[model samples]
Target: MADPLPGDVIDRVEYDVERGKVREFTRATFTTDPVHTDLPAAREAGFDDVPATLTHTVVAGHQRDQRGFVDALGLALERVVVGSVTWTYLRPLIAGDHVIGTRRVVGDERREGKRGGTMRVVTLETEYVAADGEPVVRLEEVLIERGEQR
Candidate 1:
């Protein structure tokens, strides 16, 4: 029963703010928006209580579950492939906030691609909330279970 798929609940995710994580994310992502990478600029821009970039918050929400999901399926990081990723930002995320992410299996379907094999696309819908329980953002990730498309 388990080999076909994991459970409906992915895992609970939490992110504690780290200045290094925020800074490194800003630098590496190549996002030049001052409000996203500069604290002083963000303050001047009227976001005195929050960090510059919300993208880091999004990353935090995601990275929290990568490890657990791998284990759930008895999968090896080396064997699985991240076929695609697309995120729609509903609200701006701020720094210095604790974020919680919860994922659930929203969809599961099998299909055949160009190779005419079976591929399973499992949709994981995640909701990231601020510590106050305010919805910060929502994310939907479609993981293509490659090689399984037979």
Candidate 2:
């Protein structure tokens, strides 16, 4: 496969935030916030429904795209590692919200490794938008792929 170019779209998926999923994610993450699992608590917190943890997007995206963007780009999964992840939350996601996430390639570069090989760094950005076209969260992730040793 050819190297992914900037602006290449990896995938787009729609995720439905269900109450059960929200509660499950909260418990799995060891979150003690009742607002994420209880409708009454969430209503008291000013949310229309149970609010999902900030990191719920990770699970939602992963669940929809199990192969991941790197794998979609045809990169060797064994040589790839997540270098960093940054999230910009524009709005809180709650149960009953329908979100559409689009993953795209934003940047790509290669550098010489200290160990005498090449290191490819890829930057991907995924924007999660609500059904009403409002932005919910923006996730920027950097993946590093190590080249073969000389």
Candidate 3:
């Protein structure tokens, strides 16, 4: 595949926030907040059901597509590093919520590395929308391809 350009749509995936997965995620992350694992607590907290942790999207994203955008771009896995990740939560994601996420290439550029090499920086943005068509979260990830090691 050719290099991905800005505005390129990588893929769209559907994710279901199951109750069991939410509890498992909370336990795995060592999150002690009852709102994530207990439906009653969630309801008391003003949510309809158990609400997933803010970072639960990462798990959902991976479960939907292990390869993700890096593999879609055909970049060598060993040469790529996740530089950073940022999340914007527009609303709560609760158990039983069906979300549709669309991943797109928002920025592509090259920069000179301090060690005398070129680095390819790619910014990927995934917008997750609820069943009602309102956006729930936006995730931005930066992947850096370290040019051939000198």
* Ten-residue stretch with the least lDDT total in model 1: 1-10
TM-score-superior candidate, 1 or 2: 2
Q: Write the per-residue lDDT of candidate 1 for residues 1-150, one digit (tens) a residue.
A: 253343477677888655567677778888676776677887897875336354565565456656767676444455355565555556666667677887777766767867777666677777878788988777777776665422
- Give a tens-digit lDDT track for model 2, residues 1-150: 788899999888888988998988888999998999888989998999998888888875555655765577777888988999999999899899999988889998999988788989999999999999999999999989999645
What TM-score does model 3 achieve against the real structure? 0.93
Give the Cα lDDT of each candidate.
0.66, 0.87, 0.87
The C-alpha local distance difference test score for the whole of candidate 3 amounts to: 0.87
Tens digits of per-residue lDDT, candidate 3, 4-103, equal: 8888898888879989989888988999999998778899999999999878887655656657655787677889999999999999899999999988
Candidate with best TM-score? 3
Candidate 1 Cα outliers beyond 4 Å, as residue runs: 3-7, 50-54, 61-67, 73-79, 148-150
Give Cα distance to truth, residue 77, candidate 2, Å: 1.1
TM-score of each: 0.77, 0.91, 0.93
lDDT of 2 at 109: 93
Stretches of candidate 2 off by over 4 Å are 61-68
